[model samples]
Target: MARPVPVNLALRDRRIDIFFAVVFSAFTVTSIISDLLPTVGVDFSQPSDNFFVQSNYWYAHDADPLFMNPPDWMRIITGLSAFVYMPFYIVLVYALLAARNWIQLPSVIYATMISSLTGIVVFGVEFFGEPEFRTQNAVKFLLFNLPYVLVPLVLLVRMRKPLPFTRRF
Candidate 1:
């Protein structure tokens, strides 16, 4: 038995997947440092210090409110991102880079999960939460968080066919 040859991240043949890999890798790092660490009381969410969220995500969290002082459901969502999505993201990055067919099904589930969580649940709260909970700034929310919804959908289309990496796009 022979192992499949895995391409490096910079390979041009899988341009879109390479792009996805880069974007997802960024999200993974940000999620771990900004989102996950804050959830664990790491104190990095404070804007005066942290560079990643200093002028961007911190403001969005303050504007949206659910991110900082989340309700029970939001807490569960955060936990899911931390414990579930985080590991999946790491593996997904590897699978994308390695062109592993096994990632297709998991990517499907992740696409559905993330798109719903971001596009519906998070937006629902931002748009319809009580006066105190609704987002103070809609533009920032969209700019900062839209990718969580859009990228997964793109990944879905990318993974639609069998052995997605084997096909040139």
Candidate 2:
């Protein structure tokens, strides 16, 4: 059996890679901070509340028929993201910035799981839930959620192939 070839991060365009890493890192950090604020007693229900939560609430209001209020399930999911996934994203940010070869597998796994689950739940609520809870604007809803789906997908594709290895004599 032949050994699988590995992808070389060094061979890729450094500037572009670094740019993406920086952008994703910022996104992850902002998300973590936004989610963390609520845990520290920041009220997110009001539009005048924390900027991150306020922005997110408006986005959800514009997209989801549920409006400014999230359902219990959604709240639970948000809690999970806040308490668990946010920290994981911090690690991901570091790994991405460093171009660590070991991150490829875990990144793919995390991206797939998070994106797929989010998609399923979001779309399910939009389509199958009570009429009042269905999304008013599918396009806006999808657009609002696109980053979560697309970023991970792009990462998965870029990191699908493993990094090359040099055999020790």
Encode model 1's per-residue lDDT on 4-67: one tens digit a residue.
8553334468889889889888878767765665456444335656565464356545566667
lDDT of 2: 0.64
Q: Write the per-residue lDDT of candidate 2 for residues 140-161, one digit (tens) a residue.
A: 9877667766777776776666
The global C-alpha lDDT for each of the candidates, from Candidate 1 onward, is 0.76, 0.64
Clashes of each: 0, 1
Model 2: runs farther than 4 Å from truth? 1-8, 11-16, 33-46, 49-53, 164-169
lDDT of 1 at 102: 93
Per-residue error at 160 for model 1, in Å? 1.0
